[model samples]
Target chain A: MTGVAALPGTATLAEIGEQAVIATLTAGLPPAADVLVGPGDDGAVLEVAGPLVTSLDVLVENVHFKLGWSDPADIGRKAVAVNVADLEAMGARATAVVLGFSAPPHLQLRFVRELTAGLHAECAAAGVSLVGGDVTRSRDLTLSVTVLGGLEGRPPVLRSGARPGDVVALRGRTGWAAAGLAVLSRGFRSPRAVVEAQRVPQVPYGEGAAAAQAGATAMVDVSDGLLADLGHVASASGVVVDLRRDAFEVPEPLQAVSAATGADPYDLLLTGGEDHALAATFAAGAVPEGWRVVGEVRAVGPDAGAGVLVDGRTWPAAAGFDHFGAAR
Target chain B: MTGVAALPGTATLAEIGEQAVIATLTAGLPPAADVLVGPGDDGAVLEVAGPLVTSLDVLVENVHFKLGWSDPADIGRKAVAVNVADLEAMGARATAVVLGFSAPPHLQLRFVRELTAGLHAECAAAGVSLVGGDVTRSRDLTLSVTVLGGLEGRPPVLRSGARPGDVVALRGRTGWAAAGLAVLSRGFRSPRAVVEAQRVPQVPYGEGAAAAQAGATAMVDVSDGLLADLGHVASASGVVVDLRRDAFEVPEPLQAVSAATGADPYDLLLTGGEDHALAATFAAGAVPEGWRVVGEVRAVGPDAGAGVLVDGRTWPAAAGFDHFGAAR
Candidate 1:
C-alpha cells in the first residue's frame, strides 16, 4: 500500500490547520493497554505500572525549530526525541506520550497528518505509543509533548548518585547532531547521514535500561553537550568529572561534517548540543557493552568547583542550552 | 509571610525573558509525592500506580489569551486547570503536572515567578505537584501543561458506555464560566466575581470519583458546551440524549452576567463551554447528591442520527470548539 502522503514539502505550520494535524498525527498509532480511551476523546487513560516517570517539553515555532529549515514531520520527530531522551536520562523506558499542539487555522490538514505520522514513527522506534493529546487554535505553532515511562524493576538513576571514583561512560554517538546543525546554519545542504541525524536523533533507547541493570550511579543525556550535562551531574553529585580529550573520539559522521564546514571538531564535540546521547557514571570496574569510558568522577577540591575538566585542565564551555542565552 | 510579587500592569511576555519566568513560576510551590525530581532536571520521575492517565493542553499568546486583559498567573492557573479537568473526565485523579513555556527574553523575572506561583497553587488545589518541564525562547508567549494522573482502583470511564434509558446528570456549574466570558467580552469587568470565574472556573475535583462510585454508565466533562459533549456520548453509544430545558436552571452568578451582557442565559446554558463540569449518564434511579438530573438517554429512531435533543426537539447549536473555527 502506498505510504500516507508525505508531509508537505514546503508547508509551514501556519499553513496546516490544528484539528486536521491532530487527526493526521493520530491516524495509525497503536493504543496502549491501559488506554480505556485514546485520542478524539476528552482525555486518554494509560495503563500504569510500577512508579511512573513523567516529563513535559514544549517547542514553539522559531524557538525550538525553524519552519524554513525543518519539515513538519521532522519537527514532530524532534519533539518526541527530546522528551524521550529525558526519560532515558532518568533510567526509565518511555511507554506513552501525550501531545498538545496549537497552530493558526490556515495550516493544511495534510501537513498536520504527516507530522503525526512522524510522531508515531518515532514513538514506534522508542517502543512507546502516542496515546493522548489536545489540539487547540493559537496565533503561533506550538508543540507540547509529555512522556510517561516505567522503571520496571530497577531504581531510578539520579544525577546525584555518582561516587567520587565512578567512571563516566557514554552509550550513544555524540556531537553528530551538533555538527549537522552547523552545516544547516551555514546554508549547506547536509549530507544524507547528517540530515537524518538532525531530523531524528538516533538515541540508545534501551541503553538506559542496560545501564540501570548494570547499576549506573548517575546518568544524563547530551542534549546540552557532554561537558555541560556532566557539570550538572558534578554539581548534584558533589564531584569533579575530568574527561580525557584523547578518549573522546569523534564519530566518523561528525568528522566528515566538521571537515566540510571547516568547523572545529572539538567545539562541536564540547559545545554543540541536541545530540541526545546518554552519558552516565558507573563503578570503576567493567562498564556496560556498547559504552565507551570517557572520564572519571573525582572528589571536589580547590581546583575543581563541582564541574568538568578536559584533558588535565578545567574546560570552559558555556553551560548548555540556556533558553535566554544569546547563542540560542 | 509576604505574598508573591504582583506583576507590573504593563509588562508583556516578550519583556519577561525565559529563565526568569521559570524561576518565577517555580518559586514557593510545594512538591507532591510522585515527584522524585522537580523542575531543573532532564525529566521528572513521578510515582504511578495501576495505570497513568496523561494529557496535554497548550495556550498561546494573542490567540488563547491577551496580555492586555489577563495576568500571567491567571494564564498559568488556567493551563493547569484544563489539563487536570481532562484527567478527571477520564475518572482519574491528577498526581503531577509538567509545564512547558516559551516567551521572548526581555520581560521581568518577577512576572514569570508570579505565573509559576499560580501554576503551583492550582496544582496544589488539584492534589498534584509541579514536576519537570522545559522553557525556551519564542516570539509569542505559550504555556503547555502535561498532567499525569492515577486511576486508583477503577477502570476509566469512556464515552461509549451509555445505554438507552440511562438518566443524565451534571455534577458542577455549567454556564458560569461562559457567562463570565460574556461579561469580559462586553467590557463588564467585576474582577472580584465575574472576571475571576472566567480566569479560573472552579471544578468539582472529586465529583468524577463520586459519579463513578454512583455507577455512571458513561461520562464526560463539559469543556465544549453541554450539547456538544452530550452529542459525543450519544454518537459513541448509538443512543439519543434528550434534555429538558425547563428542568435546567441558570445559576445566580450566570444570570447576573447574562443581565449585564444582555445575552441569552439559555445560550450560556446550552452552547457555552469551559465550565469544567462533569456530566454523566446513570441508570434510572437516584443519582449522586450534588448532581442535578438534566436529561434522559433513549434508543435512536430509524431516521434520526444518534445525537442530542432539547425540549422534545433536536438541539440547534454549533458543535463546540473546533480549532479551525473562528477565534473567540
Candidate 2:
C-alpha cells in the first residue's frame, strides 16, 4: 500500500477508509526474524520447520464478548490467548498468528489501534508475532485468529494415547473465568482478580512442553470445562476418568465469587469453561511439577460406561458451553 | 459431542445445532496423509517441511458478497480460491486450509453443507486438504480462510526484486470477473460464462512456480486492479511500471459483457480486479509460455515519477476495491 497520509484526528474507519487504517496499523510494528515477508504482501512467508501445528478460532462481539463488559484490548488479548492455548495444548511453541478482524465502518480508529496493541502485547507475552492478517467492514465486531506453532520434532501427544491407569492432571486455574462471567452477567462488583481472569484469562503456556517432556500421554486445553473436555479424552481413549474434587485446592477468590453470585463454586469449577487450562494424562509417578493429579483413567468395564465421572459417580453439573445450545 | 440424532428433512442450523452441523461437515470427507490430526481436535497437526507460507482473508456477507447473488457453494469455493491465490502468488505449493465460518443461527444446514462441498471441490482442484477449522453463530455470515503452503526449498520472489529493464508479464485472463461483477451489479442477465467467472474465477495455479522457475523477479495476484496492484510493485521496487493496453488480448466474453452492460471494455481490462491472475516481472524475453507481456518496468527518470502509468500517460480509471470506502 502507498503510505497514505495519516488522518489529522480520531476518524472513523469510514472517514479514513481501509488503506490508511492498514497503513497505520502496520506502522512501526517490529519485524520478525522468521517472517521472510511481512505484511503488505499478498501473504506472509515464514521460516517454519518440523511438524506444523495449527488452530483456528473465531470470536464474535455480543456472542463471545459484550463490548460493554470488556476493554477492546482485553478482547484482542483473549482472542490471541485462546488460540495460543490450543497450540500449547499440543506441546507446540507458537511462532506466529494471522488475524481476520471485521468491524463496522463507523468503528473508531482509536478502538482499532487499541485492539491491535492488545494483540501485539499478547503475542509478545507468548513470544510470537503477528506475521499477517486481513481486515474488512462488518455489521459487528469479529475476530478470527489462526495460530501456527512448531513441535520441535517431538511427537504430538494425541487424545487417543491416554491409556488406562494414567493419572489425569491439571495445570492452571479453573472456574475463575466462568465465575467472573457469572459476576459480570449479574453486574456484580466481584473480586478484581476473578473479574480480570474473566476478561483475559491466563493459560499455563509452558506446561504443555513440560508435560510432554515428563511423558504425558494425551492433552487438551480445558476450554469446555474440566469434565466436558476430559470427556473427550475418555471417549477417544475408551477409558473412564474419575475426578476427585477434594484434590483441587479451590482458590479463595473463586469461593468469594461463589458467595457473591450465590452460585456453587464447585459447580462452576466442574462445568464452567473458558478457563483455558491445560489438562493431560500422565503415567503414574510421572506427573510433572506445578501440576496436580486430579483424577485417574480406568478401563471401561462392561458394566461401566466410558465417560467422565466424579467420585466414581456421574457428575451432576451443567455440560459446559455449547455454541448453538440454549445455555450459551 | 454426543451423537445427536439428526433432525429429518432439510434442517436449519438452529434446529440441529452446532454439533450436528459439524458432524455433517466432517463426515465422508477424504483423509490426507499430511494431516496427522484432523478436525475434532483442538488443532490439526500437519506434517510440513521446508519454509511455510500462510495468508488470511475474510469475506463478510453483503460486504464481499450477497447470498441472493451467488450460490453458497460458489461462495465457499471463492473463499478458498482467494486464499489459495495468495499462496500461488508467493510461488508456494498450496497445501492445506483451515476455515472459520460464522453464520447466523437461522442459516440452513443445507447451505452450510453445500458451502463445505464447494470448499472441498476447490481444495481438491488445488490438491490440498481442509485440515481443520471452527464454526460459530454470528449476525452475518463470515468466512475466514487461512491457507498453508510450502516453498519447497525455493527462494521466494518478493515484490521488491523488480528492477528496471524487467518485463511485466501476466498469466491467466483478466477483467472477466470484474466485467461479470459489473453485469451482476447492473442486474443484467449477462453471458453465463461471464457470470460464472464473476462467481468462481479460476487462477493459473501451477504458473506461479513456473514463473519462479523462469527467473521471475517479483510476482503478485491481481486481486486489486492491475494498475493499482502493480503500483504496489512499483512502489516496492522503486521503479515505474508502464502498461501497453494494446498488448492485452481481452477475452471475447469480457467484450460481450461490456457491450451488454454499456461499460468500457478497455477500462474493465485495466482496472477490474478479482481476476486471480498472476502478474510478475521477468527479465526481457524470459516470460514463460502461456504468459503474455503486458508492461515493462523502468527506472524513475527525472521527468517521470515512479508508479504505474499507461502507455506513457497516467490512466484515468477507478483503482480496484477498498473495503472500508464508500463505493464498496
RMSD of 2: 2.0
Docking class of 2: medium
Candidate 1: tens digits of C-alpha lDDT, residues B231-261:
8899989999989998788777777777777
**Model 1 spans with C-alpha error above 4 angstroms:** A1-20, A31-34, A256-262, A326-328, B1-21, B256-262, B326-328
- The most accurate candidate by DockQ is 2
Residue A32 lDDT in candidate 2: 83
Interface RMSD to the true structure, each candidate: 3.4, 1.6
Residue pairs in collision within model 2: none
The 10 consecutive residues of candidate 2 chain A with the worst lDDT sum are A1-10
Tens-place lDDT per residue, model 1, A296-327, is: 98998877678888875865554577777634
* lDDT (tens digit, per residue) of candidate 2 on B1-328: 4453345536777777777777766766688888888888888999887889899999999987788778999998999888888888888888899989888877877788788788888988887888888988898999999999887778887778899999999987778888888888888757778788788879888788888888899998988778878888898899999999899776888888878778788888888888889999999989999899988999999867878888988888747687777442
- State which candidate has the highest lDDT: 2
Relative to the true structure, how large is the alpha-carbon lDDT of every model? 0.78, 0.85
